[model samples]
Target: MPTTAAESQFDELGSLYEDVVDWPFRRDIELPAVLHSLGDLTRSDVLDFGCGAGLYTRLLAGQGARRVVGYDESEGMLREARHREAKEQRGIEYVSQLTPALAHRFDVVLSVYVLPYVASRDGLRQMCASMARMLRPGGRLLALPLHPDYDPHSDYYTAYGFRLVSESPHVEGSPVRLELRVRGVEADVTAYYWSRGALEEALHGAGFGPVFWAAPWPPGLARIEDAPTVQRAYLRRPHAAMLDCRLARAAE
Candidate 1:
């Protein structure tokens, strides 16, 4: 059967975001550390922001979470996630990002590769604030933001390969690259490479503390040692700094 136009559009967008590709590389390296950093998440409510295919949500269910909810902006992707539920027979709920009326608070909130799509610095700040707002008191929100160092406006960027560059002491080098796959036409998508420093400030301003830290690919996992054709840094959140807990509150 021929693919529908909607699906085709989605496929293009996915490719732009590297969503069409399998990320066993990232999942293998980051998932364990991300799960471990939660301290004790057993029986806790989990929210998988940008839950592509709900893979993390399903993983959470396997980890003994009392309940899990996956949120994504893509309906096509949600359809695939629903398919997983039927195939694996796992109990998971998928929700639209537009409606928040039935919103449920969570013990842990995590957004993997969701923040950079937000566009502006203000948008990123708003996202952090929203995460803080959704958590219960003392609840943790884990966010993996694309480092700002690899921005196109920066000098460290490469037209074809990845480069590691720094913006400040608080900010470290974010590895970034752009991959041009041969799919008929050349399309370009930019991912903000992340650094440790920028993440802390964003989180602090949003109302969260940094308690743990680890690169998505700390070790064991294959490192794109040469650097990503573009890749961002990983920001670990815990209690390293004070949070503006009221920031998100005031916004509401």
Candidate 2:
């Protein structure tokens, strides 16, 4: 069995999960913010941890990353990625294992929206350790975890094409149900929420420090037809957050 159970939740999702990116919040804000945080990808070796249909894999390669690896445990999701690669022929590698040759290999590990799937502290630690191992010392890990401060009222983000139904009196490990109704694509998913302290501990335990969470910055309103209102509401308490940190050296 895998160390974490997240893959199970997404196994049947296949390519459907990839379509969520078209939602206004992700397209106008989340995607741009993350790509900007990466600075430049020119010839960078990147690992798309929990790649999920190679969305970032394709984007990273398009951004000039020399090589990109899409790693995920869901065979169904990998099937979708592989199928796309067969047609798109992007030269990206999709794998289910974190092999020895992959250790300390990537310059950046883009773990978009993966943290919320961890079911336990140990799973979170394992996920972080795996990400750290894939990253060279001083390489960056750009993780987009479900926002720790997401409005518990659930419907607070209806305008963003999704709603979060959190457990009442939620705490670390509580289930946060995610309902997606974006661009005519609908799906129901369950994710876990970890407190900020627990998240910090997991990252620290995995040899990542000085973690910085970024606020959602919508690059522009060009895409969203109704920008001002959605921007104000979503940015006020976004459903997901960006985290930037580096694998610390042994001495540091």
* Top TM-score hit: 2
In angstroms, the error of model 1 at 144 is: 1.7
Output the TM-score of candidate 1: 0.62
- Stretch of 10 with least lDDT, candidate 2: 218-227
Q: Provide TM-scores for the models.
A: 0.62, 0.92
**Model 2 regions lying over 4 Å from their true place:** 183-185, 220-227, 250-252
* Per-residue lDDT over 1-252 for candidate 1, one digit per residue giving the tens place of the 0 to 100 score: 111112223333433333323443344445665666554667688788777667677778888887788877677667778777888877888885625552336777777666544534565567666666666667666665553322343333332222323333223332233343333434444434334555567677866665355444434445555434333322222111211122233223
lDDT of each: 0.53, 0.83
- Quality of model 2 by C-alpha lDDT: 0.83
Best of the candidates, lDDT: 2
In model 1, which runs have C-alpha deviations exceeding 4 angstroms? 1-24, 98-104, 147-188, 193-198, 210-212, 217-252
- Local accuracy of candidate 2 as per-residue lDDT tens digits, 80-140: 9999999999899999998888888889999988889888888888788888888888898
